[model samples]
Every structure is written in structure tokens, then in C-alpha cells.
Target: MINVVGFRYCRLGTADLEETVKFGTDMIGLETVGRENGSVYMRGDDRDHNICYFEGDPTDHTLGLELADFDALDAAESTLTTAGLDVHRGTGEEATARRCMGYINFKDPSGNSIDLTVRPFAAGRRYFPGRDAGIDEFSHIGLRVTDPREAEKFWSEVFNFKTSDWIGWSALMTFDEVHHRFALFPSDRPGIQHINFQVSETDDVMRSNYFLRDHQVRIQAGPGRHSLSGARFLYFYGPDEMIYEYSCGVRMVDDTWRARQFPVNDASFCAWGSKPDLSVLEGPDAAE
Candidate 1:
């Protein structure tokens, strides 16, 4: 059931890829659309690129997802090699270094890194930031999971995500309808625990919270307001320490939405009362 559909790009691994592509374009506004082999390509919207840095192991990560052609990428690599996992299939120069026309790769029981592509590559216009901060797109993410209920039951049974709420054991997943594109977080190891991007309101999340405090950066919380996707966030800290967000209004669900449950404190992670250190969703190795 690996139907995913789209949420492409994120191939990070940076121990100074030109100082994280100049801190993702002069401090997280992202735009630089291309660099080759050693990788770089950025963008906040207008697809074709969403994050690629490279060079290597700053806790290397990868997350591209999208599948609908090439027979749903050969039926999601034969349903993740018949469910035992260990898929691979991406060649052709690793699908031209993942600008994608095909892809596979795997690792999910909390090891993060998944790719799944098929036909991905779109931007023929729009997107030109490099420093707008009011940029909008490249939305959800915050994965890291040692075992948030076996990574939300292996992404709700091998990939069509789902859950849309829950705070203690984390969760907030999604397949579509925005409410979340994944929020898991219960780390011990495993990467990406933040990297959202939607911004175009709440004054671009309080003008990037004083433009990341006059460029000293390191904010790590909100401009406030998100009791479950009501968005309007801020969270900072970039480059190798990762974690960069800049939300705005988010809240869209369908199928009559439902999922709830909010307990792990701080007004369920902010509701205009910011207090960031969620202890990384208090996973504590989630029952190691």
C-alpha cells in the first residue's frame, strides 16, 4: 500500500557543503536551484528541488516520497521487498542523482531514509526566494522515531500514513489534506525531527520572529500558536543542527477528520504559550 503520491525531496548530509549552501541561501529562505555532483539544489517552492545539500554524514538523512508512475514505482518495489524491507532499485546514476524519474531506497522501522520517487521534477516557473522568508511550501516533517508505536505502525501499515493527532506517543501523520505530513518524533537515533516551511502569514510567523533574532538564529520554538496544526510557528536552528520551521495557518483535514488526544504538556505543544523543549517528544527511547 505504498501509495504516497508526493512530498518529494530532502537529501541532507552536510558537514559543510559550502556551509550548508550558505545556510540554505543566506539563512533559510532557500532558492539556489542547482549545483551538481557533490549536490546542493535548494528551493522553498516551485518543486524540482526542495533540499539537497550533500558532502556527507552530519547524521545523513533522506526522505523524498512520491509514487504514481512507472507502475507506482514497480508497485513500491514489490511492496518493500514483500515486507521484509531492504529495497533498493535506484540506479541510472541513482536516478540522475535523484532529480528522479525513478527511485526506491528504504529504511523505515525508525531508521528514517526513504525515497520512493517516480517522475518527480516539476518547477518550470515560480520560486525565487533566497531570502524572502515569507516563502510558502515545502511543508511537513519531524520524523525521528525509535518507535513511536513502531513508527506509527510502520507508517500506518507500509505507507499511506494516516493518524492526525496524538501528543504523548507523538503521531500527527497524514497522506494528504495537510493537517500533517508526519510529526512522529520519539528519537533515540534516526534523523530529521524538524523542517517544515509553509510561510505567508501571521506576518510570516512574526516576520521570521524578528528575522531569527537579527540573524543570531537559534530560536527553536514558536512565534506561538499550534495546538495541533493551527500553525503560526517559528522554530529555528539550521545548518548541521537542522530543525527549521516557519509555519502559518495550517489546518486541513478530510474524511471527516477525527484523531485527537493531546497530553504531553505545554498546552499540547503550544497554543500561544511557547515552551519549545518538548524533550524531543519525550521519547526516552520509546520502550527501547
Candidate 2:
């Protein structure tokens, strides 16, 4: 069983680097750190960077998840190989993409590109938010799984992630300590469903909701609670049509915890005030 740690970073290709960086810092609450030839790095809450934007065609979107250690990485590579999945040892520039000592690349069953890395760089600097909204850390990822059943089995049986609950076909998953480091939702497209950042409280969600609206940013959904994790959340669209979420009050799970299974239903997915936003359900190829 591979012991994955948590979300590391997400890389997306953009036609304009400066526009993306400004949007990340000035609009989305991430602080800019550094920029190379064509790549811009911005971080939230002390990590060197949790999101990197690169100048390229708009089609590239990659997600990176860090394993616990080299042993875990080796175990992951072995697992992917044993599953007859193609795995690539990251080289030269690929290593720089994650700012890690080592990395291996592979695609999930849904063909979502994922990079597994060891020793991803975290700056030794303190984090002070450019626009404070009680921002804490990058939390779980919402992925557009082609088939939730197969995706859930792959993560649980192969990667050893434990399911916390199921909101219909959507699976809330985690490993070791964190509530849910990842989630799988059935969708027609093949890319990240949404990226979430956990905040401090419902106040933080309300704060961000008003702040983003005042700034003229689109409020996609929320300022309401999710029945799945029972977290208060706010989802807003960021640059490049990426969905950014701020949530609080996540539940945790360990070995003794039994998986809570629920049939896909509206009540289980959204609580009071969280109306379904079809924008989040749209696939990558949907009209922008």
C-alpha cells in the first residue's frame, strides 16, 4: 500500500504568463514567489509554491501528489507497473517542474496526468497572505473520474486510500490522517474537477465570498455547507477557468474508521444553501 502524503501542486499551461500571475496573486489570494523563463510560481501558506503557471498551449493541465518518502515512491512505481500502467521516471526539466529531488509520472485510469514526487520543495519562509481570508493550506482535490466505481477501487485497492464517505457516486478519500486528500466524481471530461484550499471557519468562507464578489470575480457556488465532509465552502472561478474552493471544518479518519457509504443523492451532496452548480460538473472540453 503506497502512503501518499497530500496535494503538492497543479501546473496549467496559459497563453500569457503575466496575466495568470496577476490573477493568482491579486485575485485568487496566492502570493507570488518567483518566475523563470516562462513559468510563474505562487504559493499560499508557506510552501514555496502550490500552483505553477507556465506559458504554453491551454491544453496542458497536470496534477502532482507527493508520496511519504522514497520508499513510498518506489512502492507507487511498482504498483503502477504491476497494474500494467505505463510509468515514466521524470528527467531534467521534468524534475524542475515539481522542484523535487525525484519524480515518476503516470496517468490515472481516467487518463488524468499525475506526477508522483518525493521531496517537493517547501520554502523555509513564512507565509503572509496578500489578501487574507483565513487561508490555511491546500486541501483535497476534486477529480473528474470517468467511472467512479473503477476510480474508487483503483485508489482504495491499489493506492490504499480509505474512503470517508460517498455522496452518490462521488467518493471522498484519504490516507493516514487528513480527512480527504482526494475525491473522485464521475464526469464526461478528463481533467481536474476542482482544486480546494481549506480555510479556518464559516466566517472565512463568507469573507472570501464577499471579497471575491467585491473584486468582481465570479462566484461559482457556495458560502454553504457540504453534507459529505460537512465543510462550509465557497467555490470561485479563477484564471484559465480553474475552480478554486475555500472550505473549513473537514472530518478526519483513521484505520478504525468505517467507510460511510451513501447512494448518490441530492441531500447527501449539498446541505442547506449549496445549490448544485453545473459549471463544476462540466468536463474539460465544455465551452468556455
Candidate 3:
């Protein structure tokens, strides 16, 4: 099993960098950490830059997750190569693009570009949010997998991601169970379903709830708690129709415990209040 550390960041290509940066930092509670030419790097409370946007057509979407060290990265390359998966060592430009010391880029079975980084850059300065949003860290991501079973096998067998729970065939995979660090669900499109940032309190959720709506940002779902992770959450649409989630007070798994999977059910998906009504069906920007 490849001992993965945690999520690093995601790269998105957008035609409007200025608008994207404004929306991410102002509304989403991420801090603008770095910039190089046409690319912008945004970081959560953690080390690695959590999100990046590059000047291009909006079609380019990629996610990066970190391995423990160079050895873990090397082992992943070997495993992928032996498995007949095409892997490319990131070059000068590619490494710079990733903002990591070293990296190898490969596609998951669903054609989503998954980047494995050895040493992702950690910012030296302290994080201070421009607003009062209580975003603590870039917690997890949801991906749209065309086939959840195949995606589950690829992440579990190849990458060592253990399953936490499932909604139907949708599998939530994690390195350590703060519920899940990544989730995969069957969908027609090949990209991120949503990006989540953990906040400090329930009040933060309430505040952002009104803040988002007042700012003309569309609320996609939630202002409620989830039955799975048990974290209070609020979901809304950000730039590019990307779903952004704010959640907090999640349960953690301990050393002696073994991972368990939960079958998908309506009650399990939501705890109290209404089940979320998402405008986007199962694809990128889908509600008509």
C-alpha cells in the first residue's frame, strides 16, 4: 500500500484569473499565498498551497495529493508503471507549475489528472484571513468518477486510500478518518465535484450562510449537519460553478480502531433538516 500523507492542492485553468482570485479569497476564506506570471496560488491554514488558478481556458482541472516522501512517490510510480499506467515525471515547467520539489503526474481511470508530489511548498508567513470567515484548513475534495467501483479499486488498491463510507456506490476514501479526505462518485464528467474547507465553529456556518446569499452567491446545499462525519456544513456555488463546502466539529478515528464502511442511505447522507437539493445533477455545472 502506498502510504499517502494528505491532500496538497488543486490546479484550475480559468480565462479570468482576476475574477477567480477575487472570488476564492474574498468569498471562500482562502488566503492568496503566491503568484508567478499568469498563475496564482492560494493556501488554507495548512502547509501546502491548497488551490491554484492558471490563466487559460476553464477546461483544465487537476487535483494533487501528497505522498510521505520521495520513497513513497517512487513506489507509487513503480506500482503504476507495473500496472501499465502511463506516468510522467514532472519536468522544470511542470514542477514549477505544481509548486512542489518533485512530482509525477498520472491520470486516474476516469481521465482526471492526479498529481503525486514529494515535497509541496509550505508558506513561511502566518495565515490571516482578510475577512472573519473561520476557515481552518483545506480539508477534503469530492471527485466525479464515471465508475465508482473502478475508482474505488484504483484509489484503494493502488494508492492505499481506505474507505470511510459510501452513498450508493459513492465511496469516501481517507488517509486518516476525519470522515474522508477524498470522495468518489459516479458521474459523466471527469473533474472535481466540490472542494471543502473546515471551519472553526457552527456560528461560522451561519455567518457564511447569510454572507454568501447576500453576496449573490448561489447556495447549492446545506446549513446543516451530515450524519456520516457529523460535521455541521454549508455548501454554495463559487466561481466556475465549483461547489465549496464549509464544515466543522468532525469526529476523528484513533489508532486502535479499524476503518468501517457505511451503506448509502438517505438518513445516513443527512442528519437533521432537509436533504440537500443540488442544482448541479452529477456533472460539472449541470442544473437546467
Candidate 4:
């Protein structure tokens, strides 16, 4: 097993870096920390950065995960190679670009880029948001996969991710279990489906619901509670139609948690009956 130790950061390519960075600060309430080489670093909580946006194709996305140390990273590279996936050991300059001590990058079975790193940098200063959105930390993400079953098996077997729950074939998986680190959503293409930040309370979720609406940002779904994780959430579309979420009061599990399956439907997605296009969550197989 790869033994993932942290769900750290995302490197996303945006069509216009300036616009995306402005939207992130003015609308979504992220703090801009630094900029270099056309990449803008941002964070919701105090780590070096949580997401980096660069000017490039909007479809390009990479998720960064932390390993225990260089030994674990070495083991991960060997494991991925033995499994027949090509792995690139990151150069020192590339590791500096990723804000890590050492790293390797590879594509998952579904072609989503993943960076496994050791000694990711942390900030000495605390985070201060551009807006008081009550953001607590950068949390989970939704990863798009071509096949849910295959993706589930690959993550659960090849790495330490374990399923916390499922809506249809899609799995809410975690390594350290703050509910889920990756919410696997089946799609025709591979990329990050959504980025999530945990806010302080339900009021944060509801407040952002109106705040985003007044700002002319498109509301994607929810000021509703999720049935699976028991968190109140608000999702909105930012630049390039990328989804960002703020949620609070998520359930946490230990070894005692039992994974349960829920059919793809309105209640499975939300407890308060706010209908998001359920097809977006379940993908092409929703109507089958």
C-alpha cells in the first residue's frame, strides 16, 4: 500500500490566472500567499498553500498527497512502477515548484494526475481570508473517473484509501478518515470534479449561499445537508465552470465505521431536498 498520510493540495490550470485568482479571493474567500512563474498560490488555512492556479488549459488538474517520508515516496514509486504505471521522480527544482522536499508524479488508473510528496512546506504565519467565509481548512475533493468500480478497486487496493460510503458505484474514500478525502465521481473524462473547503459552522454554509447569489456567482447546489457525511454545504461555480464547495460539521469515522450503499437519488445526495442535477454526481449511469 502507498500509505497516504495527507490530502494536501491541488495544482489547477486556468484559462486566465488573474481572473481565477481574483474570483478565488473576492468570491470564494481564499487567501493569496505568493506568486512565481505565472502560478498564484492560495490557501484557506495555514499551510504553505492549498491550491495553485496557473495559466494553461482549464482541464489540467493535479492532486497532491503526502507520504510519510522519502522512504515511503520511494516505496510508492516502486509500487506504481511494478503495477505498470509510469512514474516520474520529480527534480529538485520541480519539488521546489510543488512546495515539497521530494516528490513523484503519476497518473492513476483513470488518468488523473497525482503527486506524492514528502515534507510539504507549512506556513509560519496564520491564514487570513480575503473575505470572512468562515473557512477552516482545505478539505476533500471530488475526483472524476472513467469507471467507478475500477477506480474504487485501484484506490482501495493500491493505496490506503478505504470506502466510507457509496452513492451507486461511486465511493467516498479516505486514508485517515475525516469522512472522505476523495469522493470518486464517475465521468467520461478524468479531472477534479470539485474542490472543497471546510467552514466553521452551518451559518457559514447558509451565509455563503446568499453571498454567492448576490455576487452573481452561479449556485451549483445546496444550502442543504448531505445525508452521507452529515455536513451542511454550499457549492458554486467559479471560473472555467469549476466547482468549489464550503461545508461544515462533517462526520468523522474511525475503524468502527461501516460502509453503506445508497441508490442514486435526491435523498442520497441531500437530506433537505435541494436538487442538484443528480446526474452530475452519478454521471452517465444515473439513468440506467
Tell me, by TM-score, which candidate is best. Answer: 4
Best by lDDT: 4
Question: Which candidate, 1 or 3, would have the higher TM-score against the true structure?
Answer: 3
lDDT of each: 0.85, 0.78, 0.80, 0.93
Worst 10 residues of 4 by lDDT: 279-288
Candidate 3 structure quality by residue, lDDT tens digits, 183-229: 78568768888889899999999899999999999987778888777
Which of the two, 2 or 3, has more TM-score? 3
For each candidate in turn, the TM-score is 0.34, 0.91, 0.91, 0.98
lDDT of 4 by residue, 1-288 (tens): 899999899999999999999999999899999999999999999999999999999999999999999899999999999999999999999999999999999999889999999999999999999899999999999999988888989999999999999998789999986999999988999999999999999989888999899999999898888999999999899999999999999999999999999988999889999997887766556324
TM-score of 2: 0.91
Model 4 residue 213 lDDT score: 94
lDDT per residue, candidate 1, 165-209, as tens digits? 988888898999999988988878888878888988898788779
Write one digit per residue (lDDT tens) for candidate 2, span 128-213. 67678788988778887777778888888887688887666677888756768877767775677678888888898898888899
By lDDT rank, best first, the candidates go 4, 1, 3, 2
Candidate 4, overall lDDT?
A: 0.93
Worst 10 residues of 1 by lDDT: 279-288
**Which residue pairs in candidate 4 collide?**
none
Worst 10 residues of 3 by lDDT: 279-288
Backbone clashes in model 1, listed as residue pairs: none
